[model samples]
Target chain A: MKRAFIPLLILGALAVVSAWLALSFGSVNTPWQTVWQVISGNERGLPFDLVLQLRLPRAINAFTTGALLALAGALMQVLLRNPLADPYVLGISGGAAVAALCALLLGIGGLWLNAAAFAGALISMLIVFGLARGAGAWSASRLLLTGVIVASGWGAVIGFLLTVSPDAQLRGMLFWLMGDLGSATQYGVGVVTLVLGLGLSLPLARNLNVMARGELTARALGVPVARLRLGLYVLASLLTAVAVMTAGSIGFIGLVAPHVLRLAVGNDHRILLPGAALFGGSLLLLADTVARTALAPQQLPVGVVTALLGVPVFLYLLSRAERR
Target chain B: MSVQIPIIETRDLNLSIADKAICRNLNLRVNPTERWGLLGVNGVGKTSLLLALAGLKIPQAGSVHLQGRALSELSGRQIAQICGVMFQDSDDAFPVSVLETALIGRHPYLHAWAWESAADEAIARAALQAVNLSDCAHRMTNSLSGGERRRLALAALLAQDPTLMLLDEPVNHLDLHHQIDVLELLTQQVAQHGKAAVMVLHDVNLAMRYCDHVMMLFGYGEVLQGPVQEVLTLDNLSRLYGHPVRSVETPEGCLFYPGKT
Candidate 1:
């Protein structure tokens, strides 16, 4: 436990610094003292509302979304025994995106759009699980292959939806698909889930480590393999759904955060899950900061910045680490 | 006379897959201090039977009881308290340390949210030492050789410390010396602690040497089972395996060999 803390504390500290940067240094860069004064409610000006209302919520939302997606990805990787698996492995994001795109095309806004995205995510989860639990013995390959196929099928549907949508709404759909954190509100839901997931799943982290070895071995070691798998699937899917609801479909962080930790700490979920969450949160927060200030007044999508920052760094790390 | 209840028993157990009967009427009882060897050709349901006995799978018919209780009534964790299994192969998806792998055996003993105590860590370390893997406790499992992985599995089973140990092809991928060492360790555990075991072995000679009781399965649910001496005759062996077998008597008991067809 002590071994896990040093890295976690470091990531947490980095997260704090990133949040500070996001708050103080946006398009209209302000001093840290001004941001602090605004936070403490001692200052009244344009900087105050910008720091409190605009920057603070956006940064918190980005952090929570990144944390949830990365944690969900870590759990999914363990569950499926595939490092390539991300938060979107079971087609949840695909489902959510499809629903969100449809709503955008129909000019639906506000709470209804979030509701549709969640409903679609749930429907996708059911489709994959129901099909995977079909007749005969259960195998990891079967479940993973089923999910991949379902995801592909959802991709086809999403492509069709994109083609038929009117030109005016295309920008909204595309921006959402690319994941824009600028529009996110109600940061509380994602954070609550992130805490709940980390708290509840930490106890099961040991079990997740054993299960990744193999289902038969886990069962023989006395783990309720079926129940554990089901629980992980549901938890990871829920995290992904909520994340998509919060900030559209942010990519790369989910896949990259866990692998970076895997390189540092050898796949022991006890530390890896939380470590991934913190690291992922830091990454996205930093990316959001860069996105907001990189182009001055015109902000790039949070998802674009995450990939742009994540991919090259991840590749470098992968090249440095010995191939497993 | 004090009659001891069997540690593991199958009451008229029926084994099948996809509605086809693989074995039937398996009325067997395994007591403490006894070891049984399961012998069958490829695809003759040996692994399936091991899985069933370990309570990892449902019986097509009837029940498997552990210490006079139905296995279905017990949780997987509870069943694991009395029995531990070593598979022919370990999963290599994610890399874990040898010590960490061995400590998995202590899972049945720990609670859902409990971490393995220092005492548990000590036991796991002792198991690694026993397997001569103490030096490699920190080594990743994927980096180990086949023989090393086999020993790692035994070390885990040792850490489990269950009364009834179910080993499926425990000798798989082992060298000659490691094979003898593992069998000797198991035989010693059974002799000294009265531990019960059910093992599947492909080598008839090793089975004859190590196991006191043997079960030979003929295809389509026919079985020949009893005390090893009475059931392991050359004629019976030849017929059971559907190959000509020759048994030679030596100072080290009986050695069986396959005759040229």
Candidate 2:
């Protein structure tokens, strides 16, 4: 109990400090009080506008997207009972990426891209669920294999679409594929926040816990296993879709955050779910800060920065866990 | 403690896998106070029969009724509430504490959003005590020895407080003492609490000693089933194993020894 409490307290303190550092320490260094004042809507200067309009929304977007991705990843890992299973492992992100790419290449609007991505993700999850059931009732190996098959097929379709798209729209589609956080707006932030809040709450946490024990056990325990699994996949897909639509296919945050949190804490979904969300948010916010400040005048893509930082840390943890 | 209704009943049940018949035209009844031993050699479909009884496998033909309701029609949770099953080998994925795994037996009674109540916790604790695993409740399940895992599995079943228990090779890895301890516990539960238990035991001697009734499955669709002394004879044992065997009845119980004459 004491061991659990101390890490939680320390993580909580670190998150607060990170949030403050994210808001205050940019290329145009606004003072802590000024950042607070801007956040509170008491200031009306250009610095306030810079903080509120640009950096603040970007920070919040990164944090919320990270939280959503990590939550989805954690849920996916528990649901499949495989440490390697993440949001992308199920072809959910691939599906969303395909839809987003089509929207961008076809000259569709931004809002439509979000909807398209969400629909694609939902459809892909349904297909995966159906295929898994058809093959033989939610076997983890079957699900993983099915996901790989579907994801690869979808990736091929994405490649075909990209080849056929007009050259003028290619740049924007490429940026979306690479993942960017520069396009976050007030409305986008609000929408992602609402979705993230709903996704991270009680239902997902409780159901994820039940799912940690294999599906048959979950069913025997009165979990309505199929329904719960379907619901979780849909909810996770929705969260991933929103993140993908808003910030492109930000890869490693979703795959890495939950796993790191799991190593720090244990595999109890109640703790891992919330911990993943918070730690993911903090990590992404820090990554975004680096993306903006490292280049000064020009921003590196937040996705690139996160992947660069996440991979080594993730590999080290994997090796350490393997040794243990 | 004679119950009016049989806790489990099957009528002319048939099951097959890939056109290979496992069990056919099988009928059985289990009273709430009975302890039944299902004895069969390897590949005799003992596990399959137990799985069918536990509602984990669907029979191809005929019916299984649990307390007068069709087993197929009952929800998994409803079946679980009335029947607890211990599989031959369970894949323990997470490093859950022994107490946490045992507490999962309380799942049928728990609401989706609520934590396990104090009463539920107390019952789980009592189950651990019953299995002599109270001291190891906080230890990781993966850390337990094979015999300890079997005991923990029994504790999990006990925590469910079910009217019927289905055990598939429940004594597979247990030592002699622990095996006797588990059977004794089951006997006590049947006698005192009116719980019905159906177990698949490979050891005919253990089955005869502890089981009130025995169901023997021989190859080529032959079955010999009745009270232990009558059904477990030299002829039946020889026919089942496809080898010559001699059975001796000591003052304690019956034992079978394989030989050629």
Candidate 3:
């Protein structure tokens, strides 16, 4: 407990550096000192406009989205007690994607699209929760199976929508399906959701640690297992909803961030949750930065960048952990 | 002398699974400083009975009381303050340290946001010492062998320090020496601290040597409960398992084994 903070502090520094990089580099690069001057209110014009107005909000949204997804992933893993569990594995992103695509098909854009996606995510969450509970005892595997099947159903709907849509809408729908952050101009909802999630979950860190062992063991150790599980499902689903609304269906970070951190820092959630948030936020910011700049004006989806960067790192960590 | 209140009591408890009956209208009282052993054949619901007693399972009929309060009336946290349970198997699906696992004993006593204190750490350390895992505190649970993991489970239960302990197959993976050592440790704790324990065990002789009282479950909801000397006999042992039993008196006590193949 005493030394847990050192890793978090380093992750914090990494987050700061990633944010700075996001501010400085893009299709048109801004040098570090000029970017600093623009941010510090000492300069005006294109640099200031680009730094503060354009890139700043997008960068904040990227960090918030990544943090939300990663923390949600960590909680989801604990809630399911499965190492493979991720924020999107339960169909939250698929639901959001189906709704967002439907909204786009109706020519809806901006805030209404986000609202439709959020409503879709919540509805999917409730459906999975109700069906997984069923008539028998509630078990993690039951929930996982229910979520996976529901996600597939939503995938079919998304495919149908994409097939019937016009050529003009097809490209946009594909970008959203692949997860794009270019349209994100507001950070308020995502930031607040991430903060509230971390605040509420940190207090339950010890309970989550016990929960990761098994439901029966958790119940034996005095945790109100049913109630805690309900809370986790709701929290993780909402975090994923906010992330999907902020970006589209950003992957890899949700599945890989917590896992990589668990290998690096062990599985004490007190450190793992906050550490996941920081590391995940940083990783996504850097990924997005590379996404917009690497192709130089023909931006690859941020989700593509995340998977391209995350897979190798995650496999390396898993192999190293097994060796120990 | 003051009258003693049983640490745990069950009134007219009926337990069953599907169509199979475990026990019927069973009344039981376990006092402090007593160690009770539950003996039965396979599929007789010894583990289920232990769960029912620990409030982890609801009895099909009747009620279970902890220190006079109905088990249903108390919160899980409140029940945990008075009782701790040790399950038969240990599953470490994720990585956790030995000391960290033992500190889980203090979980029921902690506030939601609080970390385990120095005092809690000391208690965990003492518990590991009692289980002979003191030097392995920092080791991950996945690295521990079966016997070591079972001992670690026991250590966690000791750290819980509840008045009543309900253990299911507490000696499942242990060797002869460690089995006796763990049972003797439980005996000493019960005697010295006025705590109580109810165990589900397979070995009748170990049960005979350690428990002051015994409960035997025969098929079809029939049960026998009383002082060990009065209830654990050659006939009851034979009837309990549906096999003939033989016993030889020794300096330590009477030991029973199968009479014929």
Candidate 4:
């Protein structure tokens, strides 16, 4: 227990540093002293507005979104008992992408688009859940297979929506599809959901550890496997929905963050869940900071930077794990 | 004899897989300080019957009772407190240390928000030591050999420390020495702790040497059960396995093998 704390504390420190860097370095490049003054409420005017109104909320949204995705990814992997399972593996993101694209074609923007994406995610979850639970016994492989097939169906719809839409809206649609934290203004819901997801999942962490072994073993060892699987599916899907609604369909963090942390902390979900959240939130915050500043006035989608940064780290961890 | 309540009892229990009948009208009682061996042919629903006994599978007819209460009335945690099952294979979907895996045995006893106490860790360590896995406690489960993995499963069950244990092919993948070692450990647990065990075994010789009671299931719901001496006759053994069997008496016990045509 004591050993698990060290890595988590380090990740928490990284999260703070990442948030500070995100607030300080941007298009205007505010000085650290001014940033600190604004944070401590000792300053006023444009720097204060820029720090408090503009960057702080965006940073919170980015961190919360990243935390949600990573937590969802960890849950999906455990529930399905597959390392390849990600937050989007069950078609939740694909469904949101399709709905958000449709809303885009219909001249919808802002909050309505978020709502549509969330509805689509829930619909997709239900369909996959119902189909996977089909006339036979439910299994992880069956759920995964159903989810994969449904995601492909959603992909075709998204493609059709993109091709048929007006040429003028193409760039915005593409940015959203590729994941844009630029328009994220509502960080409150995302923050709440991240906290709730982490809080609820932590108590079930030991059951999740047993579940990683197998459903049969879990049941034998006193875990109510059926109920736990259902709860996990719902929780992970809700987390993915909130993430997509907050920042379109940010990729890589959901898949890679948990994997990297599993190497550092082992597979104990008690530590892995929160650790992935911190590590993933920090990584995305840092990635978003780079996305905003690296190209000057032109911003790269946060997804691109996430993959760019995450792949090398994930590969390094994998190689190190192999050597060990 | 004083009438001590059986740890696990099945009343008129019927178990089947698809069209195959594993057992029918089976009324079996496993008392404390007893080790019962379940013997049958491959794919004859031995595993299914074991699962039913463990309250993991619902019987096709009738019911099972644990500690004088209906098994259906118990929760998963409640059943786990009384019964521990060791599966044939250890599913390692993610990497975890051997000691962590053993610590899972204390899961049923702890509250949702509670961590394992120091005494619980001691129990886990003692279990590992019993299985000769103390040196490998910190090693990852994936690093263990097949025999070592088998021992780890046993260690986890030992840490669970239930009154009744249901083991499916406990000796599978084990070397000869480790197999005997594991069975000896189980026997000692049952005798010294007043525990009960129902294990499925393919090796008739080992069952003869270790188990005091035997239950033989023939497909189509046929079964013969009694004290090991009365139930382990050459005729019943051959009929149970659908093959001719020959036995030779030894100082230890009677050893049975296939008859030469």
Candidate 5:
């Protein structure tokens, strides 16, 4: 209990600092007092608009997207009982990328792209689920292999679409592929908040706990194993789709956040889920801040920054787990 | 025994795998208060029969009934509620705690939205205590020894509190003391709770000593099912194991020994 409480406190402090830094420090460099006043409904002119309209939404988007992806990744790993499993392993991000690319090439704009991404993710998940089931039962190995096959297939399709796309839109597609948080808006942030908050909170947590036990044991214990697995895949795909649509394909947050949290805490989903969410959100917010300020007037894509930061941390964690 | 409906019954059951016949024309009826030992050599379809009984595998030719209702008519959850099964091996090599593993036994009783209630926790705790693993409740399962893992699996089955328990090689990795302890506990459960238990035992002596009834399967899909003494005779044992066997009766119980003719 003592150990558990200390990490929580540290995480809480980190979350606060990350949120504050994200809100106060940006390209315009709004003062803390003005940022506070703007947040408190006082008008502070153009700087306030940049703070409230641009930075605040961007920060929230980074936070929620990271948290959602990480939680989805953790849930997938537990459900599939494979350490390598993640949101992308199930072709969710690939499906969403294909949909987004299609929208870009065909000149589709606005919410339709997000909707198409969600639909593509759902369809891809269903196909994986179908391939995973044989003789009315699901095998984890089969599910994983199916995910890999479908993801590569979708990747090829996405590549074909990019090849045929117009040159003017090609640069945007490349930027989206690498992932950028510049397009995050209040509307996108709201969607991410609603979906990630409600989708991954309680039921998924319990289901994941049941799933961590082997499937046969879970079935004997009264868990509807097949149904629960299907539900988790769909929910994870939805959450990943939301993140993919909002921030493009921000890579390792999903893989790294949950793993780091799992190392700190054990594999209990109730703790791992919420902890992963908070840490992932904070990590992504910090990464976004670094990306924004690292090179003045030439912001690096948030995805590149996350990958650069996450790889070393992931290696350290792996060695630490190995030593233990 | 007072007249109560049989908890599990299989009639002329035929099961096959990949077009190879495993068990054919096998019939079994287990009273609600009986503890039956299923004994056979390795690869004699012991695990397959247990799977069929647990509703995990479908029979090719016959039907299995639980309390006079066809098992096929019941949902998996309903079957799970009435029958607890401990498989030979589970792939849960992760660091799930013993308490968490045992709590999964309460899954049949819990609603999709409801958390584990206090009553559920109490049941799980009692099951752990029964297996002498209460001290290790919060310990990670992967850290447990082989014997401890087997006992923990037994504890998980006990936590289910099912009317019928079907265990496939429940004592596989257990030491001598734990094997006796688990079998004694099962005996007490049958005597006190009137619950039925069907377990596959590799050790014939252990089966004969603790089991009230025994089912011995031989080659060519033949099974001898009756009271332990009648079904576990030296002649039947010799035929089943394809060896000469001798039985010695002592004050404790009967013991079988392999011999050359």
Candidate 6:
């Protein structure tokens, strides 16, 4: 636990640096000195306003959104008892995308759209839980199969929604689907959700550790298996919904962060959960930085940057592990 | 010892799977200091009986009493504190260290939301040490060899330190040396701690060596339970297995194996 702290501290440093870089460079570039001046309250005007008001909050939002999504992913993997399970594995983003696109097609925008998306995500979660947990001795594979089928169903619905939408609205919906931090201006809700998610998840890490063994083992060990599972399901859903509500549907960080962290620090959830959170936040912020500056005038969605940056790094890590 | 309640008692019990009755009108008592070996052919519901005894499943009829209280009346945690179950197989999806896996045995004792204390760690360490897995405490469970994993599972159950143990094929997948090692450990547990255990065993010779009582499933929901000496007859064994099995009078007692057609 203590050894993991050093890497976590380094990741914390990287998170700070990513924030600084996010604020200092973008469409309208500002020097590091000016970013400092704005923070110290020694400077005012365009550079100061951009750093403090716009980029700073957005960067914080990016960090927490990634943190929440990664935490959700890590929790879902444990809940499903499958290493490949991700936040979106249970059709979360698919549900959200369908609702958000439907709202856009019907001329709904802003908070109403966000509300529909979150509602859809919750609905998908409940549906998967209900369908997968019926009657028989419920296996995690059964749960995963139900979620996968529901996700595929949601994917079809999302595709249909996309095909019918007018051309002019397509770009915005696509950006939403691919994930965008451009509209991630609210830091308060995201920050609170991240804190709450981690605060609650840390204590349950022990429960989750036993859970990772197997459901039967967990039950035999005296952990409240059903209640623990319910708590994890709700927690993972809320974290996913919050992340989606904050930044659309960022990908890769949720899937890759925990795996990488697990590969690095043994699978003790006490360390794995927090490691996922910090590393996830850093990875997303770094990706968002690249997203904002890679094309300069035309900003790419953070989701694209995440997949691009996360895949090669993950593949290399996988190869290295295989070699060992 | 004169005034004692059986660690586990099942009365008028019926068990089935998907409408096929496996056992019926079964009454059993496993007392502390008595090690029970359940002998039956595959699909005769040996594992099912064990699961029901462990409170993981409901009997089709009647009730199970743990330490004189109805199993249903006790909370899962209370049941777990009194009884530990070792499953036959597990398809683990995530990786955890061997020590962490063993620490799960301490779950019933720890307070809600509290981490394992130093004493719990010490106990877990001792359990692993007993299984000869102290060296693999930090190794990933998925990375351990088959015998090592099985022993680790046993170690976890040992760490639970339950009064009654329900083990399904506890000696499965063990090498010859480890098989004797594990059975000896289990016998020591019963003799030293007075913990009652019922195990589903495929090896009749092992049962002859270790068990104080025996239960043989006689198909069609019939069973006979009594002292090992009285219950472990070749005729009953052949009938239970639906094959010709014979026993030889060796120095170590009756050695049972499949006879000629």
Off by over 4 Å in 6: A1-4, A28-37, A40-42, A133-137
- Compute the DockQ of candidate 4: 0.83
Q: For model 4, how big is the iRMS in angstroms?
A: 0.9
lDDT of 4 by residue, B1-261 (tens): 999899999899988888788888999999999999999988888889988988888888998999999988998999999999999898878989999999999999998878889999999999999999999999999899988998999999999999998999999999899999999999999999999999999999999888999999888999888999899998898888878999888887677889987
**Over 4 Å off, model 5:** A1-16, A99-123, A126-137, A154-171, A186-201, B72-77, B117-119, B219-221
Question: Candidate 1, residues B208-253: lDDT per residue as tens digits?
Answer: 8899999887778777788888988888888878899997789987
Chain A superposition TM-score per model: 0.96, 0.88, 0.97, 0.98, 0.90, 0.96
Q: Pick the candidate with the highest TM-score.
A: 4
TM-scores vs. true structure, each candidate: 0.96, 0.89, 0.98, 0.99, 0.89, 0.95
The digit string of per-residue lDDT tens for model 3 on B1-261 reads: 788889999999999988799999999999999999999999999988988998888778999999999999998888888999998887777878999999989989998888899999999999999999999999999999999998999999999999998988899999999999999999999999999999999999999999999999997999999999999999999889899999998998788999886
DockQ of 5: 0.43
Q: Which one is best on DockQ? A: 4
Candidate 1 residue lDDT tens string, A1-324: 666778888888988898899898877888999988998889999998899888889999999999999999999998888886898977899999999998888899887888898888999999998999987545778888888899999899999999998889888888899998888778888889999999879989888988887888889878888888889989999999999998899989999999888888778888898899998888888888888889878888888988888889888997887665
lDDT of each: 0.88, 0.78, 0.92, 0.91, 0.81, 0.86
Worst 10 residues of 5 chain A by lDDT: A185-194
Residue-level lDDT of model 3, residues A161-251, one tens digit each, is: 9999999999989999889999988899998899999999999998998887677778877799989999999999999999999899998
lDDT, model 1, position A113: 88
What are the runs in model 4 whose C-alpha is more than 4 Å off? none
CA lDDT for candidate 6: 0.86
True contacts kept of each: 0.77, 0.37, 0.68, 0.79, 0.47, 0.65
Model 3 misses residue A273 by how many Å? 1.2
Q: Write the per-residue lDDT of candidate 2 for residues A39-139, one digit (tens) a residue.
A: 78899998787887777778778878888888778777776778667778888878888888878877786677777877788778778878888946676
A71, model 6: CA deviation in Å? Answer: 0.9
lDDT of 2 at A145: 89
Model 3 lDDT at residue A182: 96
